[model samples]
Target: MINSTQVSYFILVAYFDTGALKYLYFMIVMSLYMLIVGANLLLIVVICLNRSLHEPMYLFLCSLFVNELYGSTGLFPFLLLQILSDIHTVSAPFCYLQIFCVHFYGSVQFFTLGVMSYDRYLAICHPLQYHIRMTSSKVAILTAFIWLYSVLATVVMMSLSVPLQRCGNTIEKVYCDNYSIVKLACSDTTVSNIFGLVYIFTVIFGLVILILYTYMRILKVCFSGSKQTRQKAVSTCTPHLASLLSFAFGSFFEIVQGRFNMSRVPIMFRIFLSLYWLTCQPLFTPVLYGLNMSKIRIISKILYLGRRM
Candidate 1:
């Protein structure tokens, strides 16, 4: 089934048929990328500079922002460059790296969302034990584990892609998503497809279930608390909930699109889907962080005043 004479590089046909629309597309995407980068960077700076934000939630918010920043870089920048330059070709090694980074950061997003859920669960369910359970060293270890496991999971997905030689050179989307790339394999991908399905269902789906269950319990605990405590708990949980909702829903849409045997989906729809997935995590994290942290609000006020002065 393996062929040695197959293509070594894939020509991504992403957004090529747009004719005059390509320029408009580039302008829109570049603007969104700038907004994402700027928002995430601002949040990171605020969290780092504000001593009052030295807490568990803000710490995880920082990690989420970092992951989103790296993740977006792993994807959007190269694609944006290519789109602008009208270059669609990608080398095999670079293609593999693209797949690795996509899945790696995708896995990290799921894991970080799960961590955020657990953080909220602890804060709402056991307010007194929250600090003790989520201690600085413990948070460090959990963050380390998120990075480690993300790499391992990405390794599994990436390792499965290397040996499959490319017969055709056309990739449908901006980035080299595993399933899309694997479909072009000259060899059998039955095993790799199965492995990917299992990973998605068990690792990614499992994380989603855990997050939902944790949040449900958190909501129960909050409702059972005193009025003031309940209000405070609701306020604390809102940002995490918003992030989880966006991540989960956007991911669900992507997975559904991937699984469905339909090529008839509009190119514009595909483009928007890619744009949403790339932009939402990076952009929303900062908004959620600023809303959740009083220190960030205070810092923003001080900056505004300083600018005026």
Candidate 2:
């Protein structure tokens, strides 16, 4: 029986032999990490400084931007260091910590999006009651619930896996993932597998359904209303929908990579698919929201001009 203390570290075997391009890879990844941080932080700061943007929608956006930073922070620093270093290994505890952070990021993201969807639903479908229903206090509670719920879920999942006897010390992915680590266990993982699947379906599909239902109702209302209503719906909902689709696609690709045999695919493409959710969503979400939402755009422009002056 391999005890937890016996396993010092696990090897990460995701990077390819980019003999001469390692430097380029490091620089590219570093630049992307910087961009993700800078863009998300800028939006967060802008939202905080401008009291006009303190409504439920913007508050939810702030939560999302913060999660983007949180999620990327979990992976980017370690990834950059691994890209530069020859040996890609992470200590067991740090690996589990990474798993917690990454999964926590994912859970909070879905919950936050669900909350955003609910906010939109109330704002559009119940306009008269919107303000009263989604008060500042309520919004804060909901956001807090999202983070807390996610943390609890991740902790439960990690606890289920921590006691399993690990037979191997190698992870095949770029970062420590719960599923990847669980696969290393020598003991039977049927319970963990079942729990993970249940958790995935319950959380991912449930949120996806909630989002779709809200949009469908919104669409119905928009169609029955005036042209202005339709345009307003399109402008506001497009970013969220786009963001949803982006996250779904990235997540889908990741799931496929994990479940299917990827031996036939190009190594680089596999790498891209594996890191897509972490990389693209954080980088593009702020851009999408910042550009598409009129209030945010105006505020961003004002901040930019003020900085120049």
Q: Which ten residues in a row have the lowest lDDT in candidate 1?
A: 1-10
Q: List model 2 lDDT by residue over 110-219, tens digit each.
A: 78878888888888889899999999999999999999999899999998998788888888888888878777788888888888889878877788789889989999
Pairs with backbone N, CA or C atoms under 3 Å apart (clashes), candidate 2 = none
Candidate 1: tens digits of C-alpha lDDT, residues 1-309: 334235577777755666777788789778878888888887788778878877878888888899899888887788667876756788877888888887788788878879888888888788899889999898889889999988987787777777776677677777777777777778878788888789878877788788879978877876777898788877887887887788777877777766775468787787667656667878777887687767788887786697899
TM-score of 2: 0.96
lDDT of each: 0.79, 0.88
Residue pairs with backbone atoms closer than 3 Å in model 1 (clashes): none
Those runs of model 1 whose alpha carbons end farther than 4 Å from true positions after fitting are 1-5, 303-309
